[model samples]
Target: MSLTLRIILLIGSLISFYLCVKKIKQAKLKVENSITWMMGSFVLILMSIFDQAVQWLANKLGFMASVNFVFFIIIVFLLIQVFIDNIRLSTLNEKIKNLNHYIALKENSDEREKNVKE
Candidate 1:
């Protein structure tokens, strides 16, 4: 990677890491969710610092350029993060559905009991 790209990545990663922490501290982001962002930022920092390793890996992987490999890594990481988030959303949706059903059943039962009493 070029020096300019390396510097940009390094600064960007640090800023990302800092923002993640700030959000967590401010209670705007959950710690569990921020873990992925923190990890991703750390990986980017490592990659920025170790350009030689990145270049060698890119060559071995048949990438046309080290920057392409970096972009590929970032894209893959984001995809995985999105997939995991979808799984969590699905689970939450199921729980909400179950709760709503339970609430409806309880309300119905209460209404029926009131009618019988009257």
Candidate 2:
């Protein structure tokens, strides 16, 4: 990354990490869910701090530019996060449907029992 870009990323990462901590403290974000954000910001901070090492690795990996490599990593991580969220949402949806169905059945059974008694 260029010097300016590196500085910008470093600042951004630090701010992100700080915000993550604040969110956890406020109980706005759970520890488990904030772990990924914290880790990602740490990685960015490492990259910013060790610019030379990142450049070397990017060169070895055949990336024309270190910025591209950084962006690629960010995109890949985001995709993975999105996939995980999709799975979680699907599971929650299934649970909600099952619960609704069970409630409906219970209501129907109760109505039948009451009518029979009457």
Backbone clash count for every predicted candidate, in the order shown:
0, 0
- Candidate 2: the clashing residue pairs are none
- List the candidate 2 regions with Cα displacement exceeding 4 Å: none
Supply the global lDDT for candidate 1: 0.98
TM-score of each: 0.93, 0.93
lDDT of 2 by residue, 1-118 (tens): 7889989999999999999999999999999988888999999999988999989999999999999989988898899889988998999999999999999999999999999999
lDDT, candidates in the order shown: 0.98, 0.93
lDDT of 1 by residue, 37-56 (tens): 99999999999999999999
Worst 10 residues of 1 by lDDT: 30-39
Off by over 4 Å in 1: none
